[model samples]
Target: MAFLGVALLGLLAGAAVMYVLYRPRFEELRRQAEAEAQRLRESAQAQSRELLVQAQAEALRVRNEAEADIKQARQALLKQEERIQQLEERLARSQEKVDRKLDDLERRERGISQRERQIERLHREAEELKHSQQAELERIAGLTTDEAREIVLKRVEATARDDAARLMRQIEQEAKDEAEKRAKKIISIAIQRLASEYVAELTVTTVPLPSEELKGRIIGREGRNIRAFEQITGVDIIVDDTPEAVTLSCHDPVRREVARLALTKLLKDGRIHPARIEEVVEKTRQEIETIMREEGERVVYEAGVQGLHPDLIRILGRLKYRTSYGQNVLQHSLECALLAGAMASELGANVQVAKTAALLHDIGKAVDHEVQGPHALIGADIARRLGRSPAIVHAIAAHHFEEEPQTVEAFIVAAADAMSGGRPGARRETLDLYIKRLEALETVATSFPGVQRAFAIQAGREVRVMVQPDAVDDLGSITLARNISRKIEESLQYPGQIRVTVIRETRAVDYAR
Candidate 1:
């Protein structure tokens, strides 16, 4: 059994020997395979790293390209915006030019259309007139148009005189009505605003004496007092013409007043000597100077004159001894100042300035007889000399209408002067017109075409013409009166115009009253 176990062990030992020899070869092969497997893993890791680097580089390049493209696009957009703005401005300018052209075209078209219509209307009217003339020519003696027109002209000319007279009368009446209405409004307004007396002065004045024997005292021994009185007063002392009175005849009112005072004093003192007359005259002169000062002071108080120069005050005093158109110069100036002040107050003018100018308006009258210039210029020079303002001097100069009024105050002074001086019967003319005034006025009224009878009424101040009612109506009476007035104004010269009145009476007398 031992021998058989030994043979099996030897066979197993031989097989183990063969396995150990092949184990070396197998180990070598395993080692080589492990080495190849490790190398392949390393190569794969390196290739993955290179591929990651290439992808990172490509992403960076793409990012830079996108930024450059965005910048170029912004530039292109800015250029397009500028081009659009330029196009819009050009369009706006073109629209403005078109609007201007359209406005001009519209105005031209309107004018052209009006001219075309006028031309067409005139052509149509001319055609109608030509046709009418042709028909008229044929009807009138079968003559040509020119011959017919000439005959018609001759016939029209024959009646033209009457037509012309009627047309002239109508035109004159229309113009006169308009002018009279305006004049009446002005005069009425002036008269209503001004308050003055209606007293009119006469050329002759009567001085009354206490007794008839006083007249003998007025005439000194050898009639020297009467002669001296006439020479000093420049008046005709009609002592013997009337009974128990004496008539003062002088054109100057100031001279007449002086003579009256002198005669009155001589009568009161019962003096019949020339030396006593001379002494009375000196006293009368002083009294007149005092009266003149009082008159000037009264006017200043009434006119509210302040801040006047001493020279101006003296000139104001001189105005008392002057006369204008037989009216007292101081009274006239006072009335003018009142009127001017009232008007200035109404018109919002400088009231104090206007009153001062008006009060001194007639200052030139005090020296006009001695001076050689117009009253207006002389008064202005006086005012300027008295330290008056240029405006006041201008107003004083323009009061007489000798110079044009540049201000409202000047116009007011002129208007007031006219209102006071232009009243009817305000002044009397010289040269003893008493010779034939009433007779001449009556004769002038009867010279009209339809005047039947004339009577001088209102103490020869107004003449009334009685016209036949059937022959002359109220309008014709007025026309006849105007004709008579024109003749009287031209032919017969008299003092303080004689008013001509025409009376056309249509009455049925029953004597019931």
Candidate 2:
């Protein structure tokens, strides 16, 4: 028991010594822990304070932004309210103006009603007065009402008839003027399509021989070759002393051309027998017929004419070698066809009929030597025989006034013929004759009453007369123009119809100083 007590006491002493040694170290650790906790708390408090300050600043900024937005919204609302008030004021003003207009309209309506009532009263009074005046006139004239009415009716009828005649004359003059304008426009357009320099007459064809010795060979033995050539080709072969040339003359240009060509070939072949000459002449005649046929077709195509009989076409081809007054008949015919077509189109006439008639108008001249009548009449007969329309036949016949123009196309064909034949350089004429014609036209125009001056223009196609305005009124000018035109038709022998115009002009002049 004593030993146990001694051990216990040693244990207690050791514990007490251990506590004394570790208590200081434990207290030092507790102090360090407390210091770290305090340091942590201070840092946390500072961080929280800084966060609070930042939150306060953010709240201030938010509040300021919200207040500014509210201010802007209030300003916008105020502007809207001001605009609405302005609109209301404008609407009120408009309403006032509408009310005023309505009142003015009512006043005007009342005034109009008063004026209508006054007019009705005045009309009734005027009717009564007119009746009374008519009765008084009947009583004073010692006539019954019926007789007075009949006389008045006759006077009114006469006056109306006079007025109607005047109006008819005015309308006719206007129509004629319009027709003349349209005709001139169409003629001008047609003339622009062709610009022929001059017509060349073909009477004789001269064949050039290569050598002077060839002429003798052409004459052949004892003039036998020349005689055979003349008999076969129907042309006179003139073996002149001229160097290296021979002339072939014939009234028939086609025969003359064939003779010339045959003679040329004979000389080239160096064969001067009657058999060779016959063969060459026959071949050349065939070639010429072929050429004429081709020329006819070409002319027909150019003129836009169709549906002609073959015989008519052949006859038409012969016009290529025919000429009148130094003008090629074929070219003149073509020009006439074109002019007629253009004028017919303008006048609303039959264009085909016009063109066909104009083209075939001179076809008779091709065989005029064989026919016994005028070329126009012969051409008309030929056209009639060739299944042409009566209108075409008439136009062809009337182109030279052999027959009176009975249709619009006939008149157009005549006018086209005149235009083609009357153009400058189309036919051979001396300058003196042209000047005399112009002077005659002027003289005819000046012979009219009230004409102060006269001028012949458009190559004697038109005569313009200047009349004294004081002497000739509008109606008098028309009468004067008719008189002048009639006088010209009676006195002048012009190729084409001359247009007589009377011009009455009034002028007012003022000077500024």
Candidate 3:
């Protein structure tokens, strides 16, 4: 026990000594740890304070932005409310205006109803008054209403007939005098103003060769060159015993012209092969087309006609090569246009319409060989299809009397056509025969009964017969026309056909003075 006590004392003494020896060091370590902990706590406190400051700054910024947004929202709400209020006010005003309109309409409707009622009552009174007056007249006249009406009607009819006949005779005399003077003056003026020369064109064009040996070369090994030339040019090549000349025969003047040019070029170039022929022909075709276009442009400019379609101008150029009765068709058209313009200016008509119609009057002849119709109608259709005015189309259609000339311009165009085609040396028609035929037509028409006067117009194609109204009634006029036509058919051996037209006219005139 004593040893154990001694050991325990020693161990306790040793533990005490060790504790005393490490106490300062342990205190220094504890102080260092505490200082570090204090430093860490201070840093944590500083960090927390910084974080709190940043959070507060962010909160302030967010709050300011939110407040600004809320302010904008509030302003928008206020503006919207103000707009709504204004709209309400406008709607209220509109409602008031509509209400006033409704009231006005109601008043007008009531007034209209009253007026209708009053009108109905007035109509009834008027009917009664009319009936009473009619009865009183019948009683006083010692005749029924029917008998009085018939007598009055007969008297009026007789008086009107006498007045109408006198007026007709007077008006007809004045019209004839004025019309004859105007017609003679206009015709003379138009014919004097426009002078055109006639150019005769043959269907066949002769190409002169340099020598006979060249002809053999042109024949080109079994006539291949000639065959190629014919096929390309759409023209018939006539190589006969005509001295050193080859004839080009074609119905189409344009084709004939092209063939002539191509042959001339080939003869000049002295290259008589199929390939050379094709090249020469193509080059010649282009040259001819250019010439046609230039001619068309020149003629159109000369005629002072503008706004022609490209295709129309091209076709017009084609007319340069076409000939009608020894007259260049394009030249004839130009002359017609000038004459028509002069007449139209004198008569105060549409000069442009007249000139354009006259210019296009023979346009159908350009394509007449292709289209199957009268040239007048075909030309009219072409003009109409190409956006021409109705007056121009009508003038073209009426130029040949295919349709009746209705407008003054149409008549002017027809007159221009007649003047152009009937002038001396204009066509191949014998003037003596034309006059004789016209005289025969007039004689045949005037031989009919009740015929007061007979006039032959439209190149002896139509006879206008005027009948005495007293001698020939409407039905009698028809019969007279038929008889005259039959007599003309039986007596005269005319070409084509003759149109016999009978006219019976009535006129009523009154002098306000």
Candidate 4:
């Protein structure tokens, strides 16, 4: 600190001395500063000149390298251009060759088409030549060509007929040889499955009384009730000396049902007058109609038939109350259907067709009184009207053979109808009368040329004839039966139907004792 103080003192003293001595030294210091700035500028200029020289050399080297790469790239591009030019020339030549080939192919296609037409013409001419030759051959055969053709056809037909006859003969012989055993078995099968109780003429129907006095009431005031009842029911109300009961009667079922029900109500109300009787009958009529509709539908359903007319259905219902001979018609129809099915099964026929035909065979009986014609024919007409098939109509008409048996099914139906009515208990006859009848049948049958022993069965519905093996040939039975039948028809008056059976036996045996 003292040294700084002494220096400051000396500087003050020296400044006083310099201010007096070196006032002229300021110009010399300015000249020295100018000289140092000039030297720095000269050095900086020399460094810039060296940098410029190096940059120019580097730029020249880079330009030479770029020129060399450009020259190499130019050479490669020229080579690629030359190769593309060669490919273009080849493509032009190939296109020219393809155009020439296409022209040649078109010319060949035209020539081939012309040849195909020529071949077709040749084929047509060949076919015509062949046909002409055939015509010439046919003309040379005989008479005219048409006549020769007829002769050839006739020969073919004759040969066919002869072959068919031989076949039929063989079949007939074989069938006859097996007929007896097969017949027995088939008959047994038919009988075994048929279950029907015996039936008799049912002339009496019982109507229970409301009370003991109801019987008197049915007699009515002045017997008007009885008269009205009989007239309406078409039946004889036999109010006899019996107690609490009356016999209802009518041949027609609808009439009988009407009478029975009417009497029942009348007896219950204890009102015995014509007015009351009429009113009750009208009510009974409605009830019966309902029952009739239901019954008719049931019959059609069970018969497995459809599309029956309503009117026909009503008629069918009446059969429910109707009886033929003694068997109920409805029940008889079902029995017939069953028998027809069995027979059809045995015969290899349409069982449903047989059954339906048989069931409908007697449908006409329901309205026979109001219609005209044989029952079978009438039934056939009705069935046809109801849109049944022609086959069905034919079957129904021919069931009784009233019409010719056009089909095996028709004969089956007839057989079924007979089976239903003629079985024992299915119809009524006294034992003595039945026996006498059978005896007469046998007598008449035995009177035929090929004399035979006869036995009546099924209460004379059927007759069995065992002929002498020598007297009757295979066909003689049919002829003899026809003869017997003609005689029976003339000599005997029978009901329903009768079946004729001819039996022939041949046996080879040795007796041993």
Give the per-residue lDDT digits (tens) of candidate 2, residues 1-513: 999999999999999999998999999999999999999999999999999999999999999999999999999999999999999999999999999999999999999999999999999999999999988987788898888789999999978766766786789789989988877788887777655454656544889888898887888889888888889999988888889898888878788878877887888889898888999999999998998888898899989999999888888888888877778898889888988888788778888999999999999898888879999999999999989999899999998777888899988888888887776667766699889999998988887668899999988889899999998877677667878888887777666677877888999999999
Give the per-residue lDDT digits (tens) of candidate 4, residues 175-260. Answer: 86798688667656876777545454453378877567777777777888788877766789887887778888665667777888
TM-score-best of 2 and 3: 2
Count of clashing pairs, candidate 4: 2
CA lDDT scores, all candidates in order: 0.78, 0.87, 0.86, 0.79
Could you give the C-alpha RMSD of every candidate to the true structure, in order shown?
21.9, 17.4, 16.0, 20.0
What is the TM-score of candidate 4? 0.53
Clashing pairs in 2: none
**Model 4 per-residue lDDT at 244:** 79
Q: How many clashing pairs in candidate 2?
A: 0
